[model samples]
Target: MTRIVNCVKLGVATEGLDEPPFPGDKGMEIFENVSKQAWKDWLGKQTMLINEYKLASFDPKARSFLADERRKFLFEGNNEMPEGYVPPKD
Candidate 1:
């Protein structure tokens, strides 16, 4: 059976991640509260941030920035688009 959670991001009871995204307190917190769709949305935003800012994933500063953005997007309901970000043509 799929896990169900009261997702803070979506503000509804929804399907939860099968496992924590990573093994840590924060990951466990997310597994317990965040929905699959929210996590997928974060992945897309994360890719956009990496691409738009030309951030190297292995760089410490880049990782830090992504982490901050992830928290804001997941828990604080902040999904501010990066400046000058243009969506791809459909």
Candidate 2:
């Protein structure tokens, strides 16, 4: 049976992640409160941030920036896009 969480991001009870996405309190918090769909949405936005900013994943500053963005996007609901960002036509 899939785990269900009262997703903080989507304001609905939905399927949860199988394991913590990180390895500490934040990860556990997400595991307990975020839905699979919300997490997937964050992933897509994360990819966009990485690509648009030309962020190097191995860089500590980039990791920190992404962490801040992740919290804002998932919990705070106020993530910002890169300046002048344009979404690709689907």
TM-score of 1: 0.97
For candidate 1, lDDT tens digit of each residue in 4-67? 9999999999999999999999899999999999999999999999999999988999999999
How does each model score on lDDT? 0.96, 0.93
Model 2 Cα lDDT, one tens digit per residue, 1-90: 999999989999999999999899999998998999999999999999999999999999999999999999999987678999998999
Off by over 4 Å in 2: none
- List residue ranges in candidate 1 displaced over 4 A: none
Error of 1 at 31 (Å): 0.6
The count of residue-pair clashes in candidate 2 stands at 0
Write down the worst ten-residue block by lDDT for model 1.
81-90
Candidate 2, poorest ten consecutive residues by summed lDDT: 74-83
